[model samples]
Target: SQTIHQWPATLVQPVGSPLSLECTVEGTSNPNLYWYRQAAGRGLQLLFYSVGIGQISSEVPQNLSASRPQDRQFILSSKKLLLSDSGFYLCAWTGGAGAYGYTFGSGTRLTVV
Candidate 1:
């Protein structure tokens, strides 16, 4: 069975600070990884996606970035967080094409103060 894990369930940080969030998957290989951000009471917006190692695609140019260092490890980072950066960050995985649905990890809610 495939499972995903994300750390720091919630975070509070001052504006303009650095941000780093991690996600990892188990029981799967070469899965498509994605980072999505959901604003308060809004739908998710794709931030980045990785089809394979060192292969990242950015959906939006914002105060965020993503990287895939290992087959099952994905990371989201920001050099300087903005007030608008505060939201629910989610990491998801899909079994490439023909995948039915997404498997989302426990999300991290960030509050920029």
Candidate 2:
């Protein structure tokens, strides 16, 4: 079976700090990975996506970045965190042959103080 893994579940950081979030997909190959953020009560905003290794595309201009090191692993990082950079971060993947939609990670609730 295929599964997605994300970390920390919840986080609380100061106004300026470093952040690293990771996601990995199992039982799939050549998957399409995506990173999204949801504000307190707003819709989702795509931060970045990768069609293949070293092929990331950014959708928003936030201070966040994403990377795909291996075929099934994806990483999101920030050199310095900001107060407005708090939200629910999600990592999703879609590339199977079936009609199943994207499978998302458990999500990380980030709060920057």
Could you give the C-alpha RMSD of every candidate to the true structure, in order shown? 0.8, 1.5
For model 2 the local lDDT of residue 30 reads 90
Clash counts for all predictions: 0, 0
lDDT of 1 by residue, 1-113 (tens): 99999988999999899999999999999999999999999999999999899889999888888889999999999999999999999999999693568999999999999
Q: TM-score for each prediction?
A: 0.97, 0.94
Using lDDT as the measure, which candidate wins?
A: 1
Runs in model 1 deviating more than 4 A are none
Q: Which portions of model 2 show Cα errors greater than 4 Å?
A: 96-99
Instruction: Give lDDT: candidate 2, residue 50.
Output: 90
Sum up the clashes in candidate 2: 0
